[model samples]
Target: MKATIPVYDICTVSDGHQHPDLLTERLGSYLKENYQRVHQQHGHSFYHLVLFTGGSGSHTLDFTRYAVEPWQLYFMTPGQVHSWHLGPETEGYVVHFSTAFFRSFLANPDYLDRFPFFSGQSPDQVMEVPEKLRDAIQSVFEQILQAGADNEPDLVRALLLQLFLETDRHIARDGEPGVPQQKQLVLRNFMALINRHYRSLRLPREYAEQLYITPNHLNALCQDLLGKTAGEIIRERVLLEAKRLLTNEQKTVAEIAGELNFPDNSYFSRFFRKYVGQSPEEFRKSLN
Candidate 1:
C-alpha cells in the first residue's frame, strides 16, 4: 500500500506575500471552493476550530462520528484524521493556526492544551454553545472574521485567546459538581504528561512518580472522574497512537511497531487485537 491520506500544512499566501502560520475563513466559501479537500479523509498540521451557526450534518474525527448542530463548536488538534458530510446550507467560521502562531507570543507553548476542547479526545473536542452565550460567541467569531480579513494577526490572536478562554470557562461551570479544583488540575497534568511520554512510560507508577502522587491515588483519581484506571488511561493513549500510525498506508506493520517502540510486530499485533477485537491490518483494511 502507498500513502493515501493527505496531511495538510498551514501554507497559504495572500496578495504577494506569504501569510503567517494561520488561516481563517468563512465556512461557506471555504467549503465551496475546497469541497474535496474538506470532505475527504485527511489530517491537518495545525490547530483547527469551527463554530457552526447554521446547518445540520456530521463530522468524523479519529474514527468517531459526531452529529453537529447550529451553535456547535468543534476543535481538532494537529494530525487527527477528519472528514465531514453536510448540507449545502451549512455555514460557520473556521480558524486554523500552527503551534508557532501562539507560542511566539506566549511564554508557555502548550497553554492551549489546557482547554478540554483542545484535549484531542474526540468527544471532548466538540462543545455546544449554551443558549445564552451563543450570540456572544458569534460576535467573537465575527470579530475574528474581520480581523483575519484585515490581516491583523495580533488582533485575530487576541480574539482567538478570548474565544478559547470563554469556552473553557463555560465548560468549567457546566462540569460535574464535587470534583475538587486540585484534583482537576492533577488529572489534567497527568493527561499532559501522558501525551508527552506515552511512547516510553507505559506504567501507572511511572506517571504517579512524576505527578508526585502515589499510584493508588492516581488510580483512584482516574476511576472517580474518568471511570478507568491510570494504567488504562496510559494504554488508551498508546492504542490511539497505534490507530493513527496505522492510517499511514505507506508503513508496513513491522515498521509501525518499531516506530511505536514495541518489542516486535507480534507483540504489537497482540496488544492491538486484544483491545480492538481485530489485528492492525484488519483495522486498516476496514478503513480503506
Candidate 2:
C-alpha cells in the first residue's frame, strides 16, 4: 500500500467560500496551529508564497527536493504536490491566494501566465530574496497580515497586488532575459493547455491543434525553450499524473491506467517502466 496525498483548501472566513480564494498567515503561527497539516505530502487548490526568515530544512515538490532556508521565497501553483521538513526554529510568512482573487484585480483573467515563474514549465520554483530587498518584502507581508486582521478587503487586495509586482521584478531579474517575448507567450499557452488536458489529450499534435499552431512549430518551441520535444513534454506530464495516481492505493493499476486513457494495463506498465524505470507495482512497493 502507498500513502495518500492530501489536498488542502483554505477559505476567507469572513465570506463563506468552499475554497479559500485568498489567505495570508505568518509561517510560524500557521504551522504551529496546524501542525499536523503542515508537514505532509499535499497539494493545494490555490497558489502559495512562502517567505522564510529563519531556520533551515528541506522541501520536496513532486519528486524534486529543495533546501528550505532563510532569505528564500517558495511559490507553488494549484495542483503541485509538495511536502516540507523544517527545524523547530523555523519562522516565516505564507500567503495563499487563488487565481480568482488575482483575476479580480487585473483586466486579464489569466494574468499569472505573464509571470514566468507562475508558468509550471519553468524550473525556477524557489527564489532567494536579496538582502537589500528582504526588509521591503517583509514589510509588505506584515501589511497583508494587518489588513487581514482589520478585515479591510480593499487594503488587502492593494497590498497583495503590490507584493506580486515586487516579486515579479525579482523573478524577471533572475530569469533568462534572452528568450523572445513571443516565444515565451506561446510556451506559456502550451503549458497551460497541457495542465488543463493532460489527462485526456496525450498527443502533442492535439495540443498544437488546440493552440492553433502547427505540430512542427510547437515541437521546435519546446526544443528551443525546454530542450525537449513537444512529445516529451506531453509524456512528462502524463508520467507525473501516473506517479501521483500510483500513490492512491484505492486505485488499482488497471483502473489507474484506464483513467489515464492508456490502451491497456500492459501498455501502461511498459510506458511506466520506460520513463520511470519501474513497473507500477514496483513503484508502489518501494513507496510502501
Candidate 3:
C-alpha cells in the first residue's frame, strides 16, 4: 500500500477581547492540573508555548529532555513529539495555536527572514519572559477575555498577534547572532526544503543540487551550525515523521514504508531498526 500524508487540521482559539483570551486561561488551568496528575503525558499535533511561572516539571521535547522551572519558557513546534512529567503543584500558562495561525503571518515573504525564531535552532534558544513582558502578555489575554462574546474572531486574532510580537521581543533580547546572515539564509532554505519534502528526498546531495551548491559545501555548513552531517539531519527528520505516523495514527508498517518511498517492506524495516534500535512494530507497540 502506498502511504498517504494524513489530513490534519490546525487548532486555533479566537476571541474578540483585549484581555487574556478565555482559551488561554482555560488551557492554563488544564495544564496546571494535568501537569501535576500525569507524571507524564504526550502531546500530539498542535504546537504549544508553555510558560512555567511556578513549580517544576520534566519535559522530553523533540529528542531532548529538560527540567521545567519557574520563569522559564519552552516551545513545542508542530510535528515534534513531547512528553512532560510535572512537579507537584505546578502553575503556568500555555498558549496553543496551529500552523494555520503562523501561515497567516508568514504569508509575507520577509516574515521568516525578519524573525529567525522559526528557524530550527537549538531548543536552548528559549528565554525568560520578563516580568514587564509577562504583564503585557497578561494584559493582552485579559483584553481578549473582556471583549464581549460578540467578536470572538477579531479578539483572537489580536491576542495572537500580540503573542507573536511578545515572543519576538524575548528572542531579540536573548538570541546571539551566531550564524552569519548569508549562512543563516542558506540554513533556513535547507530546513524549509526538508520540512516540505523529507519523505521523498533522502540524500544530502539532492538538497545540495536544489540549493545550487556542492554536497560537500552543504555538509560543511550543516556541521558548523547544526552540529550534524547532512545525512544525519535527513535521517533524523525521516525517522521523526515515521514515528509520528506509526504511534499517533493507525497506519500499518507496510503503508508507512510505501509512503516513505522504501523499495520493499523488508528494506524499510531494516532501515528503521538501524536508526531507531527497534522494528517499527516494536516501537509502535511500546507506545501502546
TM-score of each model, in listed order = 0.95, 0.86, 0.73
Lowest summed lDDT over 10 consecutive residues: which window, candidate 1? 11-20
Model 1, runs deviating above 4 Å = 12-18, 172-177
RMSD of 1: 1.9
For 55-98, candidate 3 gives per-residue lDDT tens digits of 87677765466877776766655566656677557776665555
lDDT of 2 by residue, 113-146 (tens): 6665675532556778888899999999899888
What is the lDDT, from 0 to 100, of the residue 19 in candidate 3?
28
The 10-residue segment with the lowest total lDDT in model 3: 12-21
- The lDDT, on a scale of 0 to 1, for candidate 2 is 0.78
Best by TM-score: 1
Better of 2 and 3 by lDDT: 2
List ranges where model 3 is wrong by over 4 Å.
Answer: 1-22, 26-28, 32-44, 102-106, 109-175
Candidate 3, lDDT over the whole model: 0.64
Better of 1 and 3 by lDDT: 1
Residue 186's lDDT in candidate 1 = 90
Residue 196, candidate 2: Cα error in Å is: 1.0
